[model samples]
Target: MCLAVPGKIISIHDDGSLMKMGQVRFGGIVKEVNLAYVPSVQVGEYVIVHVGFAISILNEEEAQKVFSYLQEIADEGGQ
Candidate 1:
């Protein structure tokens, strides 16, 4: 099964004609995403990213909680 991970919208850069490029951040890992489906996203907002597109928006606290959980899992695995 595929998963749409939650990430924070850190920046946006339109090409003056289309909403097709921007940056999203997940735990300091940044990636390019398609804004074609989500043309209204802004910085400081959380979004559910899937296959280079943002499918849905998430809350700030919820995003942080996800990161916290991942950190915990990584810590456990390292032990």
Candidate 2:
């Protein structure tokens, strides 16, 4: 199954081709993600990313819930 990860957008900029791009932080990792799908998203907002693209915006509460679920999964695997 494909998994969409939740992350906070750190910064955004045009890629010179007018495409919106951003740096997103997931836990301790950060990655560049395409933000064309979320035209109204801003830095400090949480977004659900799938395959390098930010697919949707999420509130901080919702984002925290997802992080909890991910942590549960990771904890399960570590045991």
Candidate 3:
């Protein structure tokens, strides 16, 4: 199985063009992700990321809820 987590889009390339990269915060850690699919994603938005790419966008609250639930599951050591 594969897991793609929700992360906050901290910043998109100021150029706002194709071949753009962005910063995404997940589990309180930030990482660079490719935004080639959604080249228009803006800062402060959230996206679901997998394998170094942002696949889709989601709201901040919803992303946080997912994160919280995942944290709970991790704390439980899996089911």
Candidate 4:
């Protein structure tokens, strides 16, 4: 199954084009994500990431809920 995970944007890098990139933190893991889809995004914002792309911006409360659910799944060895 495919999953879109919630992560916080830590830093942003403008490539001088439409394709913007940033480092997103998922719990303790950080990965580069494409931010072009959400041009209004900024550092410290929460986003739903899938396949290295930030699909949508989410509020902090919603982000935390998803994180908690993922943690529960991990704790249950459901990965």
Candidate 5:
């Protein structure tokens, strides 16, 4: 199954191209993600990322809920 994860945007890079990119932190890992889909996204905002792309912007509360669900899945998998 394909999954999209919620992450916090830490920084953005404007390399003069139409494809906007940013550093997104998920749990403890940070990865570069394409922000083209969320053109209005800014630093400190949360985004839903899938395969190195930010597909949507969401509020912090919603982001936290997704994180909690992921943690539950992780905990269950370890048992």
Candidate 6:
């Protein structure tokens, strides 16, 4: 089962090209994600990432809801 996680963009790297990259923070883990698909994304914005790519931008409220659901699943799996 594939999952797209919600995370906040911490930093971006664009070298005047179509290929843009950014560091996205998921909880305490940070990973580099491709930002070319989200041209209007800015720092501190929430994005849904899948397979190292930011597929879409989401509002903070939606992001938190998804996070909470994921946390619930994690907690259930631990028991």
Tell me the alpha-carbon RMSD of every candidate.
8.5, 8.6, 8.1, 8.7, 8.5, 8.3
Query: What is the C-alpha RMSD, rounded to one decimal, of candidate 4?
Result: 8.7
- On residues 2-42, what C-alpha lDDT tens digit does candidate 3 reach at each position? 69988999888756566689999998799999998876688
On lDDT, the stronger of 3 and 5 is 5
Which candidate achieves the best TM-score against the true structure?
6
User: lDDT tens digits, residues 1-79, model 2?
Assistant: 4799999999999765647899999999999999999988999999999999999999767547865997889999999
Question: Which pairs of residues collide in candidate 1?
Answer: none
How close is every model to the real structure, measured as TM-score?
0.65, 0.69, 0.66, 0.71, 0.71, 0.72
TM-score, structure 4 vs. true: 0.71
- Clash pairs (backbone) in predicted model 4: none
lDDT of 1 by residue, 1-79 (tens): 4688888888888886665677898997999987777777888887888888888777667647865997899999999
Residue 5 in model 1: lDDT: 86
* lDDT for each candidate structure: 0.82, 0.90, 0.85, 0.91, 0.90, 0.92
For lDDT, candidate 3 versus 4, the one ahead is: 4
Model 5, 43: alpha-carbon shift in Å?
0.3
Name the 10 consecutive residues with the lowest summed lDDT in model 6: 59-68
Q: Which stretches of candidate 6 lie over 4 Å from their true place?
A: 61-79
Candidate 5 lDDT score at position 30: 96
Model 3 has an lDDT value of 0.85
- Candidate 4 lDDT, tens digit per residue, 1-79? 4699999999999986978999999999999999999899989999999998999999767547865996888889964
Give stretches of model 5 more than 4 Å off: 60-79
- What lDDT score is found at residue 14 in candidate 5? 76
